[model samples]
Target: MIISEGSLVLFFFNSDKKWLIRIENEKKLHTHLGIIDAGSTIGLEYGSHILTNKDKKIFLLPPNTYDFVMKSQRTTQIVYPKDYGYIAARTGLRNGSKVLEIGTGSAALSTFLASIVMPEGHVYTFDVNEDFMSIAKKNLEKSSMDPYVTQGIYDPEKIGQIRDVDLVVIDLGDPWNYLDIIYPSMKSGASVVCICPTMNQLENLATHFFHGGFIDSDCVETFIRKIEAREGKTRPSMRMIGHTTYLGFARKVLK
Candidate 1:
């Protein structure tokens, strides 16, 4: 595979050695042998081996977009890829679809959203903290989907200006306060997705979604378990990432 400059790829050796690597400008990737300048490998073909300063060979391979975002430096907890996939699927996000995302946090989900809603679509992301926004801004800039994001440092509730948006994704601590604001902005049949970690929050939000005329208020969660396989022995891994958060989705209906 031909690796793009910003594509996330893996370096491997001996058929069993692997290291997840993100391609960046002028980076010096350190290995057991020595440092390999990322600049020299930018336009190189995937699966090609590059020799380090000490002459150790390393293989290169590209990683999926999800893996790239997960490995990014995070200033805040990220929405797990499990939740992100579901959100993307249920929201019907695609090129030319406008999206509103509250509580930008580390911009992890924002980056993912931008990747799908590209070309003409734009994601209006809101965050209160400049520090978090700065980190998210840097992270998105390093990805291929940075152009689709627009940052707002104002309170989402106070702004309340999005109209006819295709989707709304809320990751704030208290999404209930913005229900009324979001309801009017969504196009008929548009979807809204919320991420909350606690059951109590879900219960409260369910009530508001129902009264606000949102249909199909469903709650879902994802659990990912990896497996270890070698020769004839294959079994579930000893550890797994579980219960990252609960996802609540609802559709807008005409009153």
Candidate 2:
């Protein structure tokens, strides 16, 4: 597809050097390779190539959800993709599924979930920090997922208007405490996921899950090992993603 003006551009120089920029007229990109005018990409198609000022081949590519998540601006650490993939699968999140997310940290998971439910469904995310919500707004905007996401402050009254959600993802410090707050928003049999950093949180959550009108509760940690593959040498990467967080899953049931 032709890269339109104001479109997000993925200028890839190589495996290690790449950037995501919006193609704006006369915007100059300064990089180690060379300076490339963002205007050069306006009429070019993705998968097309342009030359940097120093004659480096810069590949025009498309950006995906992973790109948005990795490039998002944030003050807090995000729930990495490895953990999010499992959370999404366990929640059965899909197109047209309504989601209520508490604690929109970096909007990494929010953006990912929005991508899956866009053009049909929506994600409502809230956080107490204005700074964090500001960062999340930009992240979702950059990915063009902002339209499908509703972001707000962590006002209980503000969130009270949202209800009948298909999935609820709580990324708060004391997610167990918010179970009562989110419980009313979730449909019966809908999934609720909690992103916990410590086992103590999970243990606390398990107790709440048992007494809080939720069933089929489970907790898991996801690990992703990268493999270094070559023509002859194939081995695991020296550095890989370790335990990021534990995902707690449960379904809402009648009291």
Candidate 3:
């Protein structure tokens, strides 16, 4: 859409993108190419096109969850949207589904979960560090998904009580240690996903999953590659962020 005064827009590009900027009468957008009158974009729809003074074209689109999560100010490594999407889809998170997450980090995944579970579902997130939790709470408040998030500055390891939840996702160093605590709190057939960086951690967690009365425990890792498009040659980009972490998934079952 055409970005007008006060309209939020996502600039689509292979790499460079930004948010914020207001269209005002006689205002201009300064780019390396040149300056473009902001008034020229005032009435465009979402996902429209505009030309800079240098004749460079830019596409504007409505911001999605990915856009916000990737751009949110983060003190810790934020979960990528690819992994976040997998967790949300596999866990069947939607309105009315109660989800729990540990190690809120920057609350990137928590924000995604909150978006899908809105108007009914709720997201309860625990972080041991109050500083991180406070930052996450502020981040959530600025996003559209804030209503579904309940942030708690408590250590999940020491949490003595938890309600039945539809999904439990752990993003901490020792998720396996909490399986015992998480298992009983999960509703029957509820899904659990864990994010770990090492094979040893995944292997060790698998053993805990079986012993903890969980089934179908599996591990997965996602790799993403982007392609560059130009006039003559279109090929995969050389650099990629490979092996962020491995994901382990399991389901709670009646013993």
Tell me, by lDDT, which candidate is best: 2
RMSD values, in order shown:
3.2, 1.5, 3.2
RMSD of 3: 3.2
Off by over 4 Å in 2: none
| Best of the two (1, 2) by TM-score | 2
Task: Decide which is better by lDDT, 1 or 3.
Answer: 1
Q: For residues 27-113, could you state the per-residue lDDT of candidate 2 as single tens digits?
A: 998988889888978888999999988999999999999888887887898999888778878889999999999999989999999
Candidate 3 lDDT, 167-227, residue by residue in tens: 9989988999888877767899999999998999999999999888899887999878988
Better lDDT candidate (2, 3): 2
Q: Candidate 3: which stretches are off by over 4 Å?
A: 1-6, 20-44, 49-55, 155-161, 229-232
In model 1, residue pairs whose N, Cα or C atoms come closer than 3 Å (at least 3 residues apart or on different chains), thus clashing, are none
TM-score of each: 0.85, 0.94, 0.83
By descending lDDT, how would the candidates be arranged? 2, 1, 3
The candidate with the higher TM-score, 2 or 3, is: 2
